[model samples]
Target: MALDIEQVRHVANLARLALSDEEIAVYQEQLSEILEYASSLAELDTEAIPPTAQVIALPGVTRDD
Candidate 1:
């Protein structure tokens, strides 16, 4: 699932950005790593755990830690 230069270029174009070829290549690697990390997290096993509303301590929402 390597992010290619064309995809990066398209995203830049949609955002009205004017990135050079070097910048596009750099963003491609960074974005690909981000997506891969998210994909890995999706594979975690947490079926027996209860759901919480908040990850941090808030006024009313439950805390995960």
Candidate 2:
């Protein structure tokens, strides 16, 4: 989904950002592209993949309590 200028302005306002017209235009395109990429990722099939908390093994760091 593409973001409109108004939506970008609202988001910037919420984040307390002071953006110039150029900046808003730049961010509008960038943020919209990011959302589009994420939307594409959402279409991926990962049902056969197992959920994981970590990809590598890690040793315990805490001592006996």
List the global CA lDDT of all models.
Answer: 0.89, 0.99
Residues 1-65 of candidate 1 have per-residue lDDT tens digits of 57888889999999999998889988999999998999899999999988997787668566788
Model 2: residues >4 Å from true position, as ranges? none
Candidate 1 achieves a global lDDT of: 0.89
Which candidate achieves the best lDDT against the true structure? 2
User: Against the true structure, candidate 2 has what lDDT?
Assistant: 0.99
Model 1 TM-score relative to the real fold: 0.76
TM-scores for every candidate against the unseen true structure: 0.76, 0.88
**Model 1 pairs whose backbones collide:** none
Candidate 1 off by > 4 Å: 60-65
Cα lDDT for residue 13, model 2? Answer: 100
